[model samples]
Target: MDFVLQIINGLHVGSIYALIALGYTMVYGIVKLINFAHGDVIMIGSYVVLLSLTELHVPFWIAIIVAVVFCALLGMLIERFAYKPLRNASRITPLITAIGVSLLLQNIAMKVFSANPKPFPNVISGEPFQFGGVQVGQVTIYTILISVVLMVLLELFVLKTKMGKAMRAVSEDAGAATLMGININTTIAITFAIGSGLAAVGGALYSTAYPIVDPYIGSMLGLKAFIAAVLGGIGKIQGAMLGAFIIGITECLTKGYVSSQLSEAVVFAILILVLLVKPAGILGQNIREKV
Candidate 1:
């Protein structure tokens, strides 16, 4: 029963990672850029929610919506100003710029919100559900349900919608997509918007689970989610989800049974093992380049 509870806790944390990983995978799939600043966007989202709930005195759901919209616009702006100009540049150039953008966000957030950690208000209130001698927090249940629903909606959008089809086309071949009349810039902006909006949701859920918000929270969370993306095969949407669960569960179990300090080491070690054994990732397919 104790072990089962740990698994539930893992799912709670894993869902947040999956949400963030989806953004990473989607952007990488279309742009082939890591967008290291993606994590800082999560931090921005959390702050949005924080200020909205505390200062604006809005309802929890409304705060989430505002955060999502703010982050989405912020994402589009970042893509427009920071990434668009360097779209055709060497890959390393954009990579470095992404890191710079991340640092810039961190510093800006520090200046604006200060370096202190703020307690997150409880948005969801409910008693833990006990089943078969195991108790699960309402927040955990809500997180899992919300994550699953969003993923399903995303899958439907990507597979069925016209813009999604355009996105698919762009991801396959931007040149061909442009020739076919697909507005490459708009599609990319939309992608950033969706990814960043998802990051906002992720930020809200993460703060709900951890109950603390800080300027630097996104850095480590984003790194772990990136690891999850890589573990599940970057650029593969479903793969990112799968990788997040595996990572979440592994970290939880390690922390539960092994040394808490060693959990991070174990997660990284798994990444190394996966890269050595299956560089393409569990659900990733290796595409051979034609010389």
Candidate 2:
């Protein structure tokens, strides 16, 4: 029963990781740039939610919506200003810029929200659901359900929509996509928008679970989610989800059976082993890129 409970907890945490990992994977798939700053965007979104609820005195749902929209637009702006200008520059250039943006955001957040951790409002208030010997909290159930639904919706949107096809084309070959009448810029921006919006939702769920808001909260979570992405295959959506679950489960089981302090170490060890054993990841392909 304890093991089962841990699994449930793992699912909840993994769901949030999956959301953030999807953002990482999608943007990487489209732009071929690992936006290291992606996690900081979650920090920004969490602040947006915190301010919306406390300062604006809005409802929880409204706060989440505002965060999502704000993060989505922020994603676009970052892409346009920080990334777009260096589109043709050396790859290392944009990578450095992403790091700079990340640091800038973190410093701004610290200055504004202060380095102190703020107590997050638990908008979810309900008893745990009993399932025989096991139990699940309302937040856990909501997190898993919302994560699954959003992932499904995202998959459908990518596979079925016209813009989705354009994204796929752009991911395949930007110049070819442009010649085929697809606006590469728009497709990439849309990809960032979708990914960042999902990250915002993940941030909201994560803060609710931990019930604390700190300038650095998103840092470790984002790093873990990034590891999940690399473990599952960096550019594959399905792989990101699978890797996130594996990571989440491993972390929880390690914390339960082993030491909580070693859980993160175990997760990183898994990443190292995966990289050594299969650089392409479990679901990843090793196709060479076209120059």
How does each model score on lDDT? 0.95, 0.92
lDDT score for candidate 1 against the true structure:
0.95
Q: Write the per-residue lDDT of candidate 2 for residues 1-291, one digit (tens) a residue.
A: 899999988998999999999999999999888898899999888889988988998998899999999999999999999999999999899999999989988999999989999988878898989888777898999999999999999999999999999988999889999998998999999999999999999999888888889888878988999999999999899999999999999999999999999999999999999888899887888898779
Candidate 1 lDDT, 112-190, residue by residue in tens = 9999999999888889988877888899999999999999999999999999999999998999999999999999999
Q: Candidate 1: worst 10 consecutive residues by lDDT?
A: 128-137
Off by over 4 Å in 1: none
Clashes of 2: 0
Clashing pairs in 2: none
Per-model TM-score versus the true fold: 0.98, 0.97
In candidate 2, residue 102 scores what lDDT? 90
